[model samples]
Structures are given as C-alpha cells and as structure tokens.
Target: MTSWVKFTVSIPDTHQDALVAQLSTAGFGGFVQEDDYIDCYVEKKKWTSGVQTRSREVLQRFAKEYPKLELRTETTDVEDRNWNAEWERSAGIVDATKKIVIKPSWKSLRRRDKGKIVLHIDPKMSFGTGHHETTRVCLRLMEYYVRRGDHVADFGTGTGVLAIAAAKLGASRVIAVDTDSWSFENASENVLRNKAGDRITVHKGSIVALGKRPFDLVVANIDLPTITKFLGRLLTLTRKGGVLILSGLLMTDLVPVLRLINRRSIIPLLLADEGEWIGFALQRT
Candidate 1:
C-alpha cells in the first residue's frame, strides 16, 4: 500500500500562484487549487525531511511578509490509491493552440481536432499538463519561435510537456532537465509515449549538466524566484538572438523579473498574461 503526505496551505488569493510555484519547485506534486487554498501531495517515499523544512520556510516567510493574510498550513498522511484514475477523471483534453492539443492517454480527441498536433501526456505526479495558464502560454510562445532543426533546452522540465512540444514542432534535439528524480522519470516515460525518445534526452539535474553547450532556444516554465536565480545561466546557454520563454510567474513578479532581464541586456520579445499568471519571451542580445 503506497502512501502520500498531503500539505494544504491557506493563502490569500493574491499570493496563490507564487506559493504554488514555490511548493512545486520544492518537489510537491499533484496540486489542487481552490478559491483560497492550495493542496499539494508528495509520495511518502519522496517527501524527505529537507523538503518539509524548505516548505515550512517558504510558508513562514510568506506569513511574515503578509501578516494580514493569516496564512495557515497543515499536513496529513494518507494511503494512496487510484490517483491515476482520479487525475484522468479531472483532466480533459487541453487545446494549447490551434495547432497544439494536449490530452491524457485516457482521453480521445473530437473529430474537429483531427488536424491539430496532439501531445499525449500522463503526468503521474509531475507538473505541466498543458492545463496551467503558464504552460499554455509557454506552448504558444514555443510555437511562435521554435523552428525545424532548432536545438532546445527545457529547464525545470516537469512532465516534459514543453520539451515534447519542441520535438513535435520540429526541434532536431531537445534536452529536458529537472532536479526531481520523479519528474525525470515521468518526463522520460512521456517522451517515449509521445515517440520523442529519439529526439529528446531527459536529465535529472540543473542546467550545469549541459556543460557550456548553447541552445537555439530555451524554455523555462518555473517560478519567479527560481527563474531569477538562473537568469544569468539561462542567458549564457542561449545563442545570440536565440529565444528564451519563461512562465510560472505572477503579475507581482513582473517588475522584479523584468529588471533582472533588462540588466542582462536581454530583449523582451513578448509578454502574455492568462488568468493571474504571466509568461515572457525574450531574445538573447
């Protein structure tokens, strides 16, 4: 019998996206967003003491920053069963663009979707189902910039949706990297499922694994803080005039992130907002 540790955080609506992004980076998976709270689950085997500590720290910082919000946190342990079925029941086909449709293995597309490119993904606890606003915008930006024979790097490649899309859109080679072992495994499985194993390589680590190799385009659908931390490295890895797409940001994160990008002389190519999330596309100068 498998088990999971579920953590629920009660946060102000204004801070939901930022907190969710932080938790996701801390290796929490299978999130359920509510009106005023977010629930995240991690398999007991993967929920280490360090992860708990980091999650607490993030929540504590938020609490201190916004005392009026009265943030609350709780955790529980429960037996895991039939989560895949639950996920499938809740997730339907996502139309990322006119040309891109994301569907779980269990769902079938309608007759009208015959001409669209479909990405079959089974996240299985990893993120990026193409259902999130951030991922959808990232896919749209990827469609606009990715070209045939382009080499792409998908940083924080949860579930490899973006990397898979790059390959499907004609990238010659795609490197998908994530620090979480589960995400690496899940993304690998999805790559094979999408018949992209021959063109995509999944790595369980950060950008350093690439070792000075530059990519024609780089896509990072991660949080603002994490993206800021890796901004310089991401810029370095992108070829001059190459495209860089970033998502998983909130409206509040826009100013600070843009300041960091401007300091690096990166040119902003596009800015998109969906719901409360934001995505940016830039070109290496």
Candidate 2:
C-alpha cells in the first residue's frame, strides 16, 4: 500500500488564490478547494523534508502577510486507495464556454454535445481541469481572442487545457511551458489525448525559455505574484498588437496588477470576473 501526506490549509477566502499559488510552487499537487480552506495532497515518497519545511514557510509568510486572516494549516498521513475513482467522482463535465466543453476521459458525452468542441482531459497531478474559475475565464478569453492560424504561447500550461483549446480553436501552433516536470508530462499526455500532438509543443521550463520569440496570442492562467514576476518576459513574448489573457488573480489583486499593466504601457481590453477570481485581456501596443 502507498501512503500520502495531506495538508489542509485554512485561510480567508480572499487569500485562497495567493495560497494556492504558493503551494503549487512548493510542489504540492492534488488540490481540492473548499469555501474556507484548501486540501493539498502529495505522495509520501515525494514529500521530502525540504518540501515540508517549504510548506511551513509558505504558511508562515502568508500568515504574516494577511494577519487578519489568521491563516493556519494541519497535516495528516493518508493511506492511498482508489484515487482515480475519487477524482472521477469529483470531476464532472465543465462547460467552460458555449463552444467549449471540458470532460474527463472517463465521462461520456451526451448526444446534444456532438457539435460542440469537446476537450478530453484526464486530470492527474497537474492543474487546469477547466473546473477552476481561472481556467474557465482563460478559455472564454481564448475563444474571444484566438484567430485562425494564429500562433499562441500558454505560460504555466497546467494540463495543457488552454494550449489544446487554442489548437482546437484554429491556432496554427502553440508553445506550452510549465516549470513542473509532472505538469509538463501530464500536459503532454493531455495534448496527445486531445489529438493536438502535431499542433502543440510542450516544454518543461519557465517563461525564460521563451527568449525573444513572440506569438500572436499569449495566455497565462497563473497566480498574481508569478504573473507579476514574469510580466516583462510575457510582454516581450507577445507580438505588437497581439492579445494577452491573464488570470489566476483574486478580485483584491486586481488593482495592483492593473497598476503594473499600466506601467508596461499595455491597455486592458476587457476585465472578466467569476466568483472571487478575475481575468484580463490586454492588447500590446
């Protein structure tokens, strides 16, 4: 039998996105978000002492940053059993847009969904199952901005859902980059599962790997801090007058992120919100 470590973090709703971002960067996977907290799980064999220390550090930092929230965390050891069934039970069909329906490989599509675009995704250790607000908003923005034959770059391409969507939406080519090797591998599997192997390229690296290359459209569904950290690189990788879709921000994070956008001289064309999460579409001048 296998064992897993589970970290349950309690935080104010406003700080959920930020905490998720921190936990993701710390190498935690398999997340379930609740109204007042988040549960993150990792295999015991993979959860090293360093990872545990890092997780504590993240909690400490967030607690200090949001003192009023009184953020807290608890840990437990879980005996692994039938994770696939659990994931299947938790993940249903996600209607990202009128034209886009995200369904797990295990789920059968209805007859009415025949003509609509379907993305078959098997959620593994990576993110972006199209169930999260950030991913849904990003897909909607992709539907609105992607043009036929356009080249796209999907930063932090967790599960490669956005990259696959860009390809299904008529993008000629897509470059999907993620820093996590697991996400890179998972996204690769999803791209092949979606039959986008010829159109989408998966790279295991951060935005720095993009270099000076520019794309017609760039979509990043990552947290605010990571977004801000790579803003300059993202701007440089987007062609002049190209579209940039950014998500994974809480409503409270908007003002500061918008200020940064203004400083870059990019003007946002649209602002979209779902629940507490927000996304933006900007045009590079």
Candidate 3:
C-alpha cells in the first residue's frame, strides 16, 4: 500500500519535455500530459522535501524564462488504490509506429495489431513507455539502424522499452542501464515479461556498469544535462563505425548539444523532430 504524491502543473506544451526530464531527475516518475496541464506522480516514500523543493525550483526556472505563461502548480496526496485506477485509465495502447506497438500489461491488443511488433510495458514509476515523443523518436531510429547480431546499449532505460525493442529487432545482446532503483526494477521486470532475459541484461548503475565493452548501437534517451555530462563517455562506449542515438532533447537544446557533438568526430545520419522534441542518430568515426 504505497501512497503517492501528485503534482499538477499548468504550462504551455512547448516546455513539457524539459519539465518531464527535470522531474524525472528530481525523483518524480509517473506522468500524464493533457491539453493544458501535466500531472506528475511519485511514490510518497520517495518524494521527500528535497524532491519537492527541486520540483518547485524547476517550475520557478521555467517561470523566469516564460513569465507570461500561466504556470500554476497544485499538489495532492493520492492513495495507492486511487493511483492504480488512474494509471490504468490513462495507460492506453500506443501505436508508436507502423511496425511498433506499445501497450501496458493490463491491456489486451486489437486483432489488427496482432501482426505488428508488440511491447508489453508496465511503466510503474519509470519512463519510456513509447507514450512520449522522445521514446517514439528513439524507437523509429532504432528500427532503422539495429542490424542483425549487433549489440545494443540503452542508457537511462526507464521501462526497458528500447532495450526490449532492440532485442526483438535482431540485436545479439542488449544492455539496459538506469541509476535509479525504481527504473532498474521496473525495467528488469519488463525485460523478463518480454522474454528478452536471454538477450537483454538490466544494470542498476551508471555507464561504468558497461565496463570497457563497446556497443554496436548505443542509445542515451536521457535529458540535456545528462547528455552534456556524459557525451564524451557515451561516444567512447560506441565503437568505431557504430551508431549512437540521443533523445529527450528539446528543440532549444539542439544548438548547445550540436556544439558538443561537433567537438567529436561523429557523422549525423538522421534527425527526427516531433513538435519541440527531437532525437539524433549519429555514427562514430
């Protein structure tokens, strides 16, 4: 019987991705974005005063940037049973792409979708359920690049969606890494549910968990701050001629991120933009 904390924030859609990423790092997990408001939920045991303060700081920073936007904030306590029902109602099936379909374990698939590639993801408190633009961007790019017998690594793999997809897409092996315990557990469960235990291994640590092994395809679908901090390490983890996919980027982050990328010897292959969110596919030199 785990209680939950719900934060209801009203802001423009333009800043949603940045908010979601910041909240994720701040300890908030479950997210639901509506037309005018985005609701963030976290287990009460994990949402400490520090997390609340950080969440407020995130909103204040956004307010400073867009003073005219009506960014209102509301906080409430949700009972465990209540949150479960809410999550189920909002967790509908997502037809992420022509070939990829993501659905929660509680839901059943349609007859028409029986032929498509399916991912049964129960995103308890983690991310990457293919409900976000960043997830979809990375998924499409992975479909295009993952070759047979290739090894893949999914950094900040929230619910192991991308890692599982990599295993199904012909990767010989997949490593999914997340530093947070919530994500690590959720991803581990998903990997087993997808029957990718033989091909995918979930690690609960930083990039160091990957050791010195280079991957054929590396994906870091994390926020701007994380990407900036580990860009060099991320590049080093990709072998020469291997591919790296970076997501959870807002359009505003492109210039600074590109400046970082330009410092390296990587070749950009694809840029998929969905609204203000985008994902980059680059090849190591």
- Model 1 CA lDDT for position 168: 93
Expressed as tens digits, the lDDT of each residue in 34-93 for candidate 3 is 877888988888788999888888788767766888888898998776545666877889
Model 3 TM-score relative to the real fold: 0.92
- What are the runs in model 2 whose C-alpha is more than 4 Å off? 1-3, 10-22, 33-37, 45-50, 57-72
Model 1 TM-score on a 0 to 1 scale:
0.90
Name the candidate, 1 or 3, with the larger lDDT value.
3
Separately for all candidates shown, the number of backbone clashes (residues 3 or more apart, or on different chains) is 0, 0, 0
Give the TM-score of each candidate.
Answer: 0.90, 0.88, 0.92
What's the candidate order when arranged by decreasing TM-score?
3, 1, 2
lDDT of 1 by residue, 189-233 (tens): 999999999999999998897568899999999887788789889
Q: List, residue by residue over 29-140, the lDDT tens digit for candidate 2.
A: 6877778988899889889988888888878877776777876678899998776787887798988888899999888998878899999988887888887788898988
In candidate 3, list every pair of residues with a backbone clash.
none
Better of 1 and 3 by TM-score: 3
